[model samples]
Target: MRWILLAISLLPHSLFAEVADVDLNEVSEQQNAMKINKCCEDNELMVDSVCRLVEQYNQSAWIPKFKTEDGKDTKVKHYRFINGIPRCETTQQRPIFDLGKSEDQLNMLSDGRLLHLIHHKHSTEDIKEDLSNNIYSIHENIALPEEREPASYIYEQDKYCMDKILLSNSNITGVYALICVPEVKINWRDTDFILKKILNPLFHAIAMVLFLLEAIIYFVLPTLRDLAGNIITTISVCLIVSQAADLVRIFTEFSNHVSFMITDIILYISLLGAFFWLNSFGFYIWKTFKSRNVFLRVTDVRKYCYYSAVVWSTVIMMAALAICAHFLLDTGTNPNRKMRSHFSSSIIDNDIEQETIGWLGIAIFFTPIAFTIIFNVFFYVTTLKVIKRINIYGRIHYKLKGCFDLFLQLSLIMTIAWLFLLLSWLNFDGLIYAHIVVNLLQAILVFYVCVVRQSHVTFLLRKSCCYAEPVPTGEWGDEMTHMNGGNY
Candidate 1:
């Protein structure tokens, strides 16, 4: 058979030279039209002689519009599909894939695309939103079990410490393990909460009002604005600032449980001011005892100004150190204060951690206050001792006797108030209420002492109203002169 075929092939071609050539060029018009209709001219991912396609939407389907917390409505760029190629929207700007390219989409996709013969539906709504992600995840699974894994340029949502995002890929599902994150739970202070929101703000407001009143009395009356007047002005200013800060905390977003470094700094600054004035009072008591006199002069006031500068400078430095140390401390164990809008980063939670006596509270505020209170008590005792010694040696100065008695009473009240505060830390729930009551009434207590009861303060208030100036009977006529280190 092979020999016969070879002999037939070897025959001369001249025998069939007149045979007409088959006209392959004469294709029918219907076939040409069919080719035009069926062929895919421009394709993005063409493989195995198959063309991939995607629906180009005039209205965005991949990038979803979202409202931000700041009230700005904008589109979220997370996905992109251009020319049937599914991709992440990593570029700053991209052109439209195929808008107005399809009319009816009778044999086409809607908010969907074809890739490697697989159809993926993507949209801004419902389950279709993650269509591209799912497709890529499924594609990633095509890697051989033992082969080098393709480096991914994407990652799914975290399975721990956030919402669950399970991908439908064999590689991800088979390897994924549910992790148990250690979440820190917080317990707020019920008593402190009441005080923080209600009583504390009330206290601050009352104190602020009283402070302004006293400041006005002193500032308007030159004769009243003496040494104690000077000290009172400073006290008023500190109280005003402290109370204002408290009011701010209550009314603003700082009311949230999260610790804010800036808030802490502000709060501590106010606390420092309060303590500084308190210490200034202690200094005055010390000076009284040392001098064995009740009079001060203009030169003495200047000296005290220098003294105030030195003392307050030390206080500012100490406060700074405390803040630095607080920043250095671990936030995990004691009264855990983590920032609300951040994770795994340091932030100041409180000037005084209400839940526990943290180092910052101790070093910066509470400890200093405690020491100042103690020193005030010491000064009170020493002043009384000196008065007694004076009585024993010489004559009892009748003019200063009333002032001493009133001072003693005021000192006792303040001591008791602070003592209750210290005792409240024992966690006796009832004592906490007592603590709030006493502390909140600080303005009332001060009002009664300085404005209502104290002869000198009462005299100053009356003196400011242009009343006839009588030599103060309790020798308080010379109180300012005496306080400023002058002879009465």
Candidate 2:
């Protein structure tokens, strides 16, 4: 009897265990159902058991549709999409009884109502009480004409009219007419003008003046006619051309398309030339520093010719590639094209074509510049390592050290300016301002480094001014003697 009781207790334990497992499974299923339902919000719907946004939910559709009291179909003048939601405004049409009358009038009343009048044996008048607030609200404060002239009459007669209102006959019937009122103000201040017009052009002008002065000094002074000086002069000339073109593009309005294109090409070529010359400067410094013979002349006519050929050829080729890409490529749009078109008087009729060209132009222009800067950085690092070794051993002369230091400073300034320019294209906030400031200061920095602090330049200036006697066998003398020998 006791064994039977033990078996019965064991059976109850097994049954209770089975019941608990079923209860837990039921609880889990209920929890999963709750989670699935909770995953989607009110604005979302379930598709394939996954939550997704309702792409076409427009809250404006709930509002009552706009209609004219005359029951005529409203004509949609323009429509645009904002965040995937469609927004459009319609123009109301008023009919005239006679087609030959020159005095049929449409007027904007003091309270923003449009008054339409027909002249005949008995005059008929219709006043449109409700106007599109988005359109007519801009002229609410300004006093518009009591009689709105037809667009054709305004064009033929050249009469002064309100800025934004244009009246034209409807396509369906010559007697019926529609009035155009833009949804936005045309004369509002654009914030971008502050950068493009005021800041960039001013800095570019200042840089251009400094570059011009530097170029003049390099060319006129017989003391500065070495290979290094020639290279610096070329760089200055290129920058001058670029800055002049840029200033012209900003200040002058281009009425001719071909002229504008030519100016643009010239600007790109000159810009590329400036950067390529800078790279040439780095290459020359590297070659000079890496040479084993310390007595070897730094100036070589054949080598300068070679560098000039290479830099000019590369710049022209890159500019040609940019032109070809602008004509050929049909990829994604450029975001800044609209801004350019708005600021400049050049009207871009084809959006896709202009966008492709703009983007391609940017790519072609910046790719080579970026590579040039990178190569310059590599050359600078290698040369700095050599200079560091020489400094440790105390074998390098002070004049040679000063020359190298000048090259280093110029390279660093150019590299940093170009890097900031490249970063500005990423469209980060305030980076453009930083780029402008750095580039604006670049000309002054270059002048200070290459002219003011340069031992050779100061030595020549002092000798010319009778302020000090010329040193016979020093660093500047050695460089000048070698340079003159190579030139002759």
Candidate 3:
């Protein structure tokens, strides 16, 4: 209730420091004549006029020219102008707003340089485009200041061109003007926020809770802690930590200044965890089928710990290098001009060296990832072929069941999510939606396959629900085949 009240209290107040709610009598507010610096090619005369008619304007919109989509019009909510002229390049003329303003003469030379502030929301590589060429099609030449703070603002310095401008003010949503700086606002009531933060986190939380429940179950049955289970549990732990950090990041507005670094570190940890464990899972599946036994000799804790230390060390070193890239290359006044965490992905779009410090991080993080994917694919296919080969000596029914069990293992390890990610990398339009859904639900799907559906867990659940006494471990069915090897 207190959090709800606090959020409500914050809603009515636009968190913008001084621009939006500045006192009308203050210095910047008093100079209502919209101020902008404009320059052009050689022999360009001094621009001495201010558009006065803009003061009485009621409402407006900033239309943008999207270079990524040919002949299509796009809209931008805001723009930031560091120091640039809003001009029409094709006509070789300075932009003249239809609104009223005065032109005053001043001595100045034409300098063909301009700076443009862009969207507070960064665009994904597939959909992002430069719109400078289309700036002349719009009447307004100022960036619109945000009306309300948006939730989950992501502005990466992947490159921003001042050529495209979208301007807005306190009341009107300006068509195209560059703003100086903007703030992202997230509202509890916003539907988009509900979907991305509130509801999405619920899915992740459910997955985490289910993983914990399964961990508790596995703890009581000490024999269940085989290499496969160990890998599954570790992957669960990684997902839990990753999701928890994402929850913190999306919900807390101020966390980016402090807790965000931890989030960045954990992201890599989760990625590595998934890679190593998924490969191990494929191996466990293949080994079980070849040996025709559910139980494999477990490695000693010392060896397991040593292996973990090596993997964690590798992850930490790479993450630290990305951290160095973040600080070393991020040299600019623009807040967006910095390294971003999303660049940790293997996708080439994120390796925007010109706009972000992704070159170092991409090389270090994605190399092993590419190999992991290739090996996992190899293992998965080989496992299926081996299963089919083994089926040659088994009954028809048993052969079918074996193939089905392998299919379940594929689902548990999130084959679909990787497929979607690959599709997204290929730039298949409209697949990002599927990619997000499959990725977010991975933990839940894993829990369902690896735990809830397990014969022991189901038996235990039935006994508990029926108010029956607990069964002895000796009576547990086919203990050797916990999941992938369960049928044995």
Candidate 4:
């Protein structure tokens, strides 16, 4: 409630900040009369102008352009002057805006036409007046007219040749504009604070409660026979770790910055927990089909494999941190002038180098990922195949194969969304939409799966059948042909 009230109190200023940005764009369009920079050749002056206009609106950081031959920062000084000049091969002349710089000497230049630049001294009072009068809402406040008298028209034409110029001075090139940064406004009611904080915990909480209930059933309810307890217990641990990581993420986002190493460690542990937990559930399935006499031995081996994955995942977590750090350090050291060339070159170079030296790193990140899709496809196909040949217990076992398959599938969907987001981060579009959808689906899926486990009997039956089969400890379930003995 306090957050909501605070946000409401800040709404006016936020609205004002938005209006201020719009005004800046308009002013920039008026001042920047021409566009043709060293960055782009063979492009029309208008194209360059429009690019600059949009870039300014989008708040693209200023990039330093150096003339290595001349040993000068060409971007700051002369680039703005020559930006609109056409190429030697082109006959097109770019229209230039006059800032009303000097009115006394309006004469033709050596190039055959004289152009005047307009300059305005803006004051805080003037800005406040404009805002109070709501000039931002008026369309014609800064818009150029379609028709004008000859000399007056020339003045207007010369005043603004480019689309818009918010600000210009001796030191500033092109359109340099200021944006009033808005105050942060977090609303509890409007911004979903409850959803954000409670959503992950709800999944974990349900998992925890179900796990406790299952544990109680193991001790109390004599006929509550089911492997669902163990499965739920494993899944509950994963969900708990996941929720812990989520909380850590929220803290990092909202609280004081912490070293990346701490974050990496936290993430590593969380992901390891999830990876191992899921694999453990898979091992449980392997144990389930083993012959009754060999059940204990197979279960032990399966347990070992699950623990191994957890340990390996932890090691891979450290490796992922190193790989990420390498990229960050490589990208962070260069100045603006070298950024474009450096990054483009690094992608080509690093792709080859990382492929070899970072092989484990890539596998750690990508294998479970590649296997996820493979596993899902195999699950769908094998499920269909087994559905045809299996008995009632077999079908039940198949259905309840993974303790938290629904949540795992949801996580897989989130992983797919995350992969696309990674691939497109360089030029991410609709990123917020992708983030919201993935998070919402994850929360919804997790909550649904955890809450629905209260009455599930499929896992219990599968456990019973897994312990009932008979075979040698090493050769357990080696032949499905023996499945016809009704041992399952």
Ranking by TM-score: 2, 3, 1, 4
Better of 3 and 4 by TM-score: 3
TM-score winner: 2
What TM-score number comes out for model 3? 0.49
lDDT of 1 by residue, 323-417 (tens): 76675663433222322211111111212222222445446666777687777677777877776776333222443354455455555665576
Residues 168-229, candidate 3, lDDT per residue (tens digit)? Answer: 22121222222112233446676544555566567667767876776666555444454445
Candidate 2 residue 159 C-alpha distance from true site, Å: 11
Candidate 3 yields a Cα-based lDDT of 0.44
Per-residue lDDT for 276-359 in model 2, tens only?
A: 888888787787678876556545567789899999888888888888877667333322122132232111110111121366
CA deviation > 4 Å runs, candidate 4: 1-235, 246-257, 283-367, 392-430, 457-488
Relative to the true structure, candidate 4 reaches a TM of 0.37
**Candidate 2 residue pairs in clash (backbone atoms < 3 Å):** none
Best by lDDT: 2
